[model samples]
Target: MADAEMVRRETSFWRHAVVTVPAILLLGLASGWVSNSGYGNPWFDGLAKPQAMPPGWTFGAVWTTLYILLGVALAFILQAPNSGTRRTALILFGSQMMLNFLWSPVFFGMHQPRLALAIIVVMLVLSIATTFWVARIRKAAAWLMVPYMVWLSFASILNYEIIRLNPAS
Candidate 1:
């Protein structure tokens, strides 16, 4: 009977994990689309990018994967039993998500690469802290945030380069 209960609990935990991926992906897509709609298409093509700038397709692919991971991490945190650590984790997670959502608008829609770079730096720091907090509850949750942190690091560099190359943009 005890073994059966353990199995049931594990199954419940996994069910939440399975649902998180799609929910996060959808949120990512919605935010991306909303920001994309406000920006002028010609602006992107006309910008003077640094030589190191990635192919246009890469941005979408990388963000999609990171967003999925973010979703899973969040789901794990949500599943944790109520505790002070869980509350802090939720706050950190939500803060980073808000920052992530704002990035597209600042960079593409407003055409402020410098500001975007600054925002990304903050986002990176917050994400790292959030990862640490989540690790306290679930190590896998913390590990899941690694791709996002790495991607933001690269993005910050790219944003700085763009600001340097396109001073007038």
Candidate 2:
């Protein structure tokens, strides 16, 4: 019985991962593409960038890795037995993702850095809450989310610096 249960749980995790990883990748890529974010965008290219900014290729690479990590974290959470903790984690995760999807549009499509910054701040907070809630159920799941939070912090700094450099923007 124990072995069967373990196998079932493991299968559940993989099944969720198969759905999660690709969805995250697609949604993230689509968000960036729809907004025309990054180097090719004329408005973004014209803005003064922070000195610490990485090359154009770096964003895609780092975000790809981070999104994969986040997807795995989410899969782990989803695989856990349903409960209030899991529900809270899922809520936080969905909320953060919504804001995540909104950021590119608000910043690049709408040209509103301040509002985008606010959205990022809230997203980061929700991500942290999700991490903590996931931690209550699965330590490894929470561990997977750490890099995302770290990257979000760095991205927030970059966003702030961009707004500071181009107050007119």
Candidate 3:
């Protein structure tokens, strides 16, 4: 009986993951594509890139993996019972998602690196909050966000460098 209950719970988590992973991946891909965030954007291509900037393809690869991890994290959170911590995690997660979706447009579409930097910083804070709140609800979910936080740290540095390098831009 215990094994059966465990399998059922595990199935529920998997079911949520199946829905969330693809949804987040599609949204992330769409956001980047719609805003022309990467190599082909004229403004982006002309910007003063940091010396440590990875290859163009690396962005897609890293983001794809990060989004999948985030989606799985969301699924883990979703499978948990309702509580104050869970609600806080959900709110923070949603805030992060909104900021994430807005970032490419703010930077690549509107050509506002400074504003985008602000957004990214707030997003990072919210993501950190989400991870902690998720830790209270689901420990594994918190681990899933580590890669995302690390990537955000790198991206923040890159954004700062772009602004520093192109003071006139």
| Per-model TM-score on C-alpha atoms | 0.89, 0.98, 0.97
**How do the residues 78-147 of candidate 1 rate in per-residue lDDT, one tens digit apiece?**
7888899999999998998888888887777786778888889999999999999999999998999998
Error of 1 at 10 (Å): 2.9
C-alpha displacement of 33 in model 1, angstroms? 1.2
Model 1 lDDT, full chain set: 0.83
Q: List the residue pairs that clash in candidate 1.
A: none
The Cα local distance difference test for each model comes to 0.83, 0.94, 0.94
- Tens digits of lDDT, candidate 2, 59-87: 99998998899899989989988899999
Q: After superposition, how far is residue 151 of candidate 2 from its true place, in Å?
A: 0.7
Candidate 1: C-alpha RMSD to true structure equals 2.3
Whose lDDT is higher: candidate 1's or candidate 2's? Answer: 2
Ranking by TM-score: 2, 3, 1
Sorted by lDDT (best first), the order is 3, 2, 1
Find the 10 residues in a row with the least total lDDT in model 1: 35-44
lDDT of 1 at 88: 96
Clash number by candidate, in order: 0, 0, 0
